[model samples]
Target: MSYGTSFNYETILICLVAEVLNLLTTFIFYQVLKIPLFFDTIFIVAVVFYLGFVPAICVSIGYSLINSFMWICKTGFFDPFIPMYGLCGILIVFSTWLFAKNKSDFRISVSITLLYLFLIALTSSMCSIISGGLIDYFHYKYYEVTDMMNPIKNFSEGFIIQHYPPIVSYILAQIPVSFLDRLIATFTGFGIYRSFDFFMKRR
Candidate 1:
């Protein structure tokens, strides 16, 4: 294989490792801590601090890959779903990082987390809409409701005239998820730091 081939292989390996790590972290948070969705922000933040951009990028890419694979295996390799999952991960991580960086005090952190959750939900909803649209395109069928449009359709025709408002509402709904994630991150970070300190003191 040429250098390009080697690089491609390496990229795939990295993506696989990242996917495994992402799943492992999510599982631990869900099973051990009994919380999911909320702690994802915390995990991403921790990864950012410990491993920086590489890990963040890998996490996003890995998430996309795993989700895409699942979609493919379950529903046959649909093209729109691939971009939908992949792009959503990237956007979520990017938005989360932006909010995390702006956080200063506890209040700020909370606010940021809430904002982050809102943005995530909105982006996710949009992605879902895009995914649905793609499905409709490929299948040549009209969807009565896309993810972002469902609530509006259910409520009234003019309930949400544009996609952006629904995204905002979705993000607001994710506030609790963000709060839970932050709480878990704090406890986990303190526990690990204290353990390290105790061992260092003895040494």
Candidate 2:
């Protein structure tokens, strides 16, 4: 391993842990909370906060692949939002890596952590909305009108669907939930990693 281009073992390990946590949260959301999409970007953001740009990119690539694979296995089709999942990593890597150069800075103060969480929320919100719009576009583009009663078959149910102005309604409906989901995951993931890091240091 060299200085800049070495294999990021630590990043890989943390990303794996994050992936496990994502699975758990997915169960909680769909099985319990009854949400459709998986909402978790905290691990990726936390990784960027610790490891910087390159590792974050790795996380994004790995996370996107894993997420897409899992969804395809479950639903027997490809999800339209794999790119958005990757986008979350790109946003976190660049935003946090450019803003905070060192690991210590991320955990330095409560304010900084909150700020980072807010940024993750904002980024996730934007990506989710854009992805939603893209998905809707593709859905409508290939839509085969079966009957007048239900022209939009297999369309995702949301405020945006069947609305007068779908794009605006969809975005507006997505923001509140997206912000809250990312914010919670950001805080939870950051705290879990930092706490684990603290114990590891003691060991």
Best by lDDT: 2
TM-score of each: 0.42, 0.68
lDDT scores of the candidates, listed in order: 0.45, 0.57
Angstrom error at residue 203, model 2: 2.3
lDDT of 2 by residue, 83-176 (tens): 4446645654565455445555666788986786677557655665565455545544564323221212233345445663654544455455
lDDT of 1: 0.45
The number of clashing residue pairs in each candidate reads 1, 0
The CA lDDT at 170 in model 2 is: 40
Weakest ten-residue segment in model 1 by summed lDDT: 149-158
Tens-place lDDT per residue, model 1, 1-203, is 11111235644554455456556776576546654342333344344333344556566675656655765686554545344545544554554445333324224466664555455445534443444333433322332334331221323223234444554434443344434444454345334433544675799
* Residue 83 lDDT in candidate 1: 43
